[model samples]
Target chain A: MNKRELAKRVAEKCGQSQVVSTLVINTFISCILESLEAGEKITIQDFGTLSVKQQKKRERFNLATNKVETYLPYDYIKFTASKSVKIKQKEKSVKKE
Target chain B: MNKRELAKRVAEKCGQSQVVSTLVINTFISCILESLEAGEKITIQDFGTLSVKQQKKRERFNLATNKVETYLPYDYIKFTASKSVKIKQKEKSVKKE
Candidate 1:
């Protein structure tokens, strides 16, 4: 589902106005963005974990030109779903099959 | 940050009561869970995308016993952060260095 649909559902489930729900959802998104930007990880239990994983700097050679280049180290966010969620996902596939 | 802390921040940012915010947060979690359970993907733009990725079934060998075992195909959720967030994270690293 997309953000609008998801926001609508959240508003209904929480009995909040859509406008307010939109703000809350956006705030939550910004909060996560800020956290990751500050080098902190956000862990919402049973949902999943969002954290930045480090990528090492290294040198790579171009196969075609036979030239070497250096790459800088960086970090990227990684998400790992909880085991319960994983099981639920698998159960759906099993039922379909 | 953990759930409680994140919830508090969300509540403050949205100017919602903590009790209600908790419900909203939990509901959002359940919404995502239900979506994935039904084999649907949840895409929250700017923050990241959450979707199920498939893994192919394969056979693996036990190095010690030399016994082969079959593994069933399955799906798992994956998250990809937005480019803006990636840039923000990198900025923090640059500042620290």
Candidate 2:
């Protein structure tokens, strides 16, 4: 499923037009991106939280040179879904297969 | 930030009412959750994709008994932000401090 498909489903479930749903979806993404870029974490109840975490730099082997190399530290965004969501997914997968 | 803050920002940016924006945001999250629970991956351009990945079961030690124990397999959701989003986040963090 992509954005378009998700938009269609959202529109159907929310009883809204697809165009409006699509715009809302896009705007939601933009909003999330803006918040994350501003160093803010977004949390949704019964879903999960989106936040940026700093990854520590460490020495890694240079495959070509076989020498230790230092890599720059950076941030990574992580999402940990809620337990209820995971259980629902597990049940669905189990039923399908 | 939290959902309310995000909704405010989104409403301001999109020129939409907070109620509508909140509804849209909630719907968007629900749509994504549904897709993931259906074992389908949802991708948003310029943002990221939400997918469930299987985690292999393995044997682990029972702390109290200190004996080998079988662990159940499960699924985990992962979100990898796009390169552009990462760059923007890095810049924003750097400027703030």
Candidate achieving the largest lDDT: 1
Candidate that scores best on TM-score: 1
How far is B20's C-alpha from truth in model 1 (Å)? Answer: 1.8
Cα distance off (Å), candidate 1, residue B27: 1.0
TM-score versus the correct structure, for each prediction: 0.86, 0.83
Error of 1 at A12 (Å): 1.7
**Consecutive 10-residue window with the lowest summed lDDT within model 1 chain B:** B87-96
Which runs in model 2 stand beyond 4 Å of their true positions? A90-97, B62-64, B87-97
At residue B13, give the lDDT of candidate 1. Answer: 85
Candidate 1 stretches greater than 4 Å from native? A87-92, A95-97, B87-92, B95-97
> For residues B1-97, could you state the per-residue lDDT of candidate 2 as single tens digits?
7788878777877777888778877888877877777778778877887788877677988999999997666778888877667634644435333
| DockQ of all candidate complexes | 0.61, 0.58
Residue B14 in model 1: shift from native, Å?
A: 2.1
Q: What would the per-residue lDDT of candidate 1 be over residues B9-50, giving only the tens digit for each residue?
A: 999988987886787778888887778777787878887778
lDDT tens digits, residues A43-94, model 2? 8777889887877667999999999998766788888776666534745445
Query: What is the alpha-carbon lDDT of model 1 when measured against the actual structure?
Result: 0.79
Q: Pick the candidate with the highest DockQ.
A: 1
